[model samples]
Target: VNPVDRWDGTPLADAVRAGHRQVVEMLSAAGAELKLDVSQTSVKLCDKAREGSVEGVRLLLDGSADVNAADYDGRTCLHLASATGNLMMTRELLKAKANVNSVDRWGGTPLADAVREGHSSVAKALLEHEARLEFDEVKTSSELCECARQGDINGLTMLLTAGADPNACDYDKRTCLHLAASVGNVAVVKRLLEHKAIVGAKDRWGGTPLADAVREGHEQVSELLLAAGATLDFSAERDARELCESARLGDIEGVKLLLAGKCAVNATDYDGRTCLHLAAATGNLVMAKELVAHGAGVSITDRWGGTPLSDAVHGGHFEVAMELRKHGAELKYSRLKTAGELCELARVGDTNLIRTMLAVGAEVDASDYDGRTCLMVACATGNMHVVQVLLDAKADPSVKDRWGATALADAVREGHAHVAKMLLAVGASIDLEPSEVVSRLCDYAGAGQLEHLELLLNCKADVDAADYDKRTALHVAASAGHLHIVEHLVSRGCRVDAVDRWGGTALSDAQREGFTHVCKFLEGRRQLVVLKRSSSQEQLNLK
Candidate 1:
């Protein structure tokens, strides 16, 4: 009842819709008030009222449910009841002091709902309650922002005419005019300008409407703002400074503009760090690539005597380091090293250095001082790219570290399903005895890795593999709500009714964990299995 669903539908609505009168009565007695926000189409009370359930409506009203709670779309219970042509429900709502002229999200009142839904009696009843025939309603600033977002000029006018603030700022301090200009809503922009919306208003991000238009490539919107006294404000020294700042902030838009205006790509900031150096330090591959394309030298050293490639490697941007290498930036860190250095590079995701070491006859399966192999370190650190590189070099995933854990175990333990699947696919031996093999299968099943589970089953791993608590892979899959894995296990001849040590069947486990889809699947499979047994018994009797 407290944690509403994504649509903001409450538990009370669910009870009403399910016709659970007793639960509704209890919840009502607990003081569950009807509250509809912007996303709700209609409330549970309204849904009940629309179905002509007078008792349900009465129960809700007795519980102090507001008769006039409007959804984001502005549809109330009376509107729903009128549209649904539920005369008794409408009368009950009207009698409960429901507002007759409450407008919906679309600004239609209950009388309009009645008229449009072909309920003349409901319309007459609403008119009797002083309901207006015309469509009109006050619009809030939020509604004006929504109109601006949708490029709805007519909606903007209606809201403006109804006294909505032209310069109203939303939660983020973004005015309606800012939103209109961001999406290049020219008509809405002009309308807002006519209503005297502040042209120089800055949002929470310090971005004005003109800056937003320029950033988004809205040339017309930019020109309009410029004609309305917005300045471009690009100076030579400022461009050089902003270039490095954009590279540091990873602001691709600002960098692009500065680049298009022929600004120096290799311009140094006050600290003597060029744009390329900043991009490398920030590990922004796209920004680095853009800087490289604009003639920024990757070999250019910063004030601290670090090249862009050195900065990339030091910042753990192995991908950026690789890109710099592709552009002929000399590798400085690929010199010969002990097993410790290779392990360190692998741990840092320096795939290029690993490749270089391997090419120079360095052992691909070398263990660190702590007895952890490069493969184990990569898998444990959740570095999939480095893991793939080591795997391609034929590094053994079955090698145990100091604690007797293999790369496969590390991948599964770290929730790296892709890495675990790769290990299994590449024939990393699960050569443990029966019980340990079953435990490994349960790990993959628990991780919800359908691909890994299928691979394990193909590798002669038992489909009915169970862990320590007698929890089968089915129990694991059901608890985790992996429907596909559950179906695959059942189709692979795994027992449908296998119970764990807790005396819980897969169905019961799914139910306990609130995995509704898995519960339905397990229940359906169990019923089908029962029906087959019954049919077979019936045939034997006939024989």
Candidate 2:
């Protein structure tokens, strides 16, 4: 019974595939063990279910085949049965203890697959088993839209009766009517009209169901929607503007309509910008591909003299930008120093985009027009993700901008202490001269940056350097009620007795600022010093 055929089909798998229910029962009685871990065994069960052999599936389950065994792609027999609309096979699998809510490696649950494959009965069965759904309403708008698109009248009625809003819209604001009209489902359209689905609803791009039908060349659907009060809402000038708007918004339907209407493929608006230009600028690769396929000029520049590829790169949309390059779009400059693009991406914390730019031959230390390196931009914006990626790419943290400030300087100046720690760890020098060290020390002390202040002290910065306001680290720390900094500075020999230009001693400032802890610490230190002096004088008298 364990012997395998050339196709690796065991006796049980072969019997199940051949639809021999009695043979499967006999094999189970004879103790022919199932290959639960073997991918081929699971594949055979799925294949039988996929072929709509309900008895074949039942036989396999009765013969001790694992109901939840999944194939290499993580799809169990239940998934296959549900996808193929085999309701009986699904029921048998579920009765055999199959997982109703199992998700595949691609995050597709059986319920999602069932709905997507238009298996309303199987979907209902899975829901009865408590299959997790993306929405808790009677049905998601996507499910309702799918039912209409596929002409499943029963599914549509079930969802609407269960309180799924007929007027429910998707992310692009397309309703069930829009989807039904787009696919030219006449009966579904009639059913949706009976349910009072809005006939004149405009999507995000102001395209109605009639416009959607026309765009898809569904003349019958268009006539039906128009008879039920759908409007055209399209003119020559409106088409040009809508094309640009749709391209920017990544609306594939609206772009297709403008293209079909023979609105010039290269039609330009007041900005002398074509749909390709808008698509590239907004990182809409779908619209970009469509425009290019319709013979939109890739090399054409806008009034600003920027081509589509240049605009894409400038917006840090490197994937779409690369797509443009694949279609022979010229680069405005060398790929070696795409600094402006890198800086923009770093500011937005797009580590993947920065990696893509570097992979395309961008220099790691490339600086923008303002001389700010990508690392500095990342540090200033507190994007630790981008900072880590730049550091891994061996970005030199020591490179200064036009202001002579390093990445570490920007991190410290911008109050990004964690970013400063990363910069310092990577050997970015904060080794300032004595004068600069004093200024920075005061800044750190006042801001309560304990770790950075400790690092500065380790670098031998003066503990008592006063700023232009004559405020030493102690005065600033005490005024800010930074108890830790006040204690650290005092330990490092900052003169607590010395007054600032404002005529305020550290203790006085602490008292005036209501820093009780700082006041107690300063008072304790003064008392200790006085007691030590008194002890010294007593010892001198004894001598």
Candidate 3:
């Protein structure tokens, strides 16, 4: 008979807990069995070892304890020993022939766990024991790749030398080289190169190692790969799109290298955006200047019929817009007067520059392709100071955007309470449709500013109004797990059972979103008998 009862015994557990090695050994000989149900076992000896108690660990292991046994959480003795830098325990486990590569439930190998815990010595020991690198185990490779992506040369080199498959593609077909290049890990790139790794390997998105390096501004890694004969134009199938993305990312060296390697600088993307257009759209002045200097076409327009100058101004690149204007760029497709000039100035919040533009006859009320006036953009961005300048310049604040949404609507929708207050003070209408008003209230409530929501309510905005999805402020507060906001909304007499367009009540939405507190509050208000009983029982247990 097992001396320890299977269901209700703690002899082995108690001995380990008390750190009584002699008692543990004697009990083991006298037929004390370790519970295989790890939740009840002395396998947690590793936890004691991690806390720097070598004797506690020795008691269990010497008693024929399973050295490779894991805790309830799948954390092995090695994981604990390695994480805590207990080299003696580590050596003992290695002697006991513990599986060096066993991982925890979290996919954390001893080496990875050691590195994470800053135990370099333990990590070195695990490496020497031939702990498998490049964790090909389904649950752990991505994290291991992330380590390589960070250019941990010691870890990377160890993994590579330990027979880790360097070309093992991740779920996205991204090889280790792809990660190294993306992070500009020059040394790791060189090491991978020595292993004869495929230099031009493409990821799931068809992004090559060179493309990733260039896209991320990894110039040194790019040079290294180039010297190793990695194809610069290997992604020629999507060269135009890739180059545009590179320009949009502000990669000057990548732009230069691609251009030098004979990528068509003026090649249009699927959206008809050229390298210059991407540069202009992102406000990359240096890249725009460089593209222009390299003979990139300035006349290319996007699908929306807007040129590079339009992109620059719309994205708030004043200097880039000016540069493009100096290059004779046109805003012919824009409805705004002096579109390039005024939008750029407004974008920078440069009141003085805007005044200069106005003095020189730039149009004050010019609207964009989207029918958005300077004041609308200012209000949308919550740049109240800029809105004041535009307003003083006679820019119409009442002008609606393409959505029939005015500046006040934009401010409220984006939770700019101060801007909304200013707009309301300036005689902006508060009599919006009930649905729109409630949508704005939800936006404020979602940002956790009950004060803003209260202000909207005080302005005579409807509290029970529903948005396009028929979601009221109560629904928004509940879904965001803001218990206080839920309480406030409920206290304000907002309907607790208000259902959305999908026929889901606020209580259902809260439960779906994992908002337990909101669910409890809503359930409490509903007087759900079971929930009330459960709450009472919980309170009694607590007492």
Please write out the lDDT profile of model 3 over residues 137-255, one tens digit for every residue. 33243543665688777766655555566777877888878888888878888888887888878788887788788777778988888888887664444668777878977878777
Alpha-carbon RMSD to native, per candidate: 25.6, 19.8, 22.9
TM-score of each: 0.37, 0.42, 0.56
Q: What is the lDDT of residue 102 in candidate 1?
A: 85
* Global CA lDDT computed for model 2: 0.78
Which segments of model 2 are wrong by more than 4 Å? 1-267, 278-296, 310-318, 328-374, 431-436, 443-472, 475-483, 490-543
Which whole-number lDDT from 0 to 100 does residue 140 have in model 2?
A: 68
**Better candidate by TM-score, 1 or 2:** 2
lDDT of 2 by residue, 1-543 (tens): 767767656787677667787888888788775554557657768888888877766777776767887888988888898888888888888778888878787666777677667678888888788775434323367788888887888878756653467888888788898899888899889988998999998888787887777666677888788788877766555565667777876778767866775667777777777889889989988888888999988878777677887778667788788888888887454433477778878888888778756654568898877788889899889888899999999999888777677887777666677787788787787545556767888888889998778766654567887777777888878889999999899888888776788788889988999989999999998788788889999999999
Cα lDDT listed for each candidate: 0.74, 0.78, 0.75
Any idea what lDDT model 3 has? 0.75
Predicted structure with the largest lDDT when compared to the true one: 2
Clashing pairs in 2: none
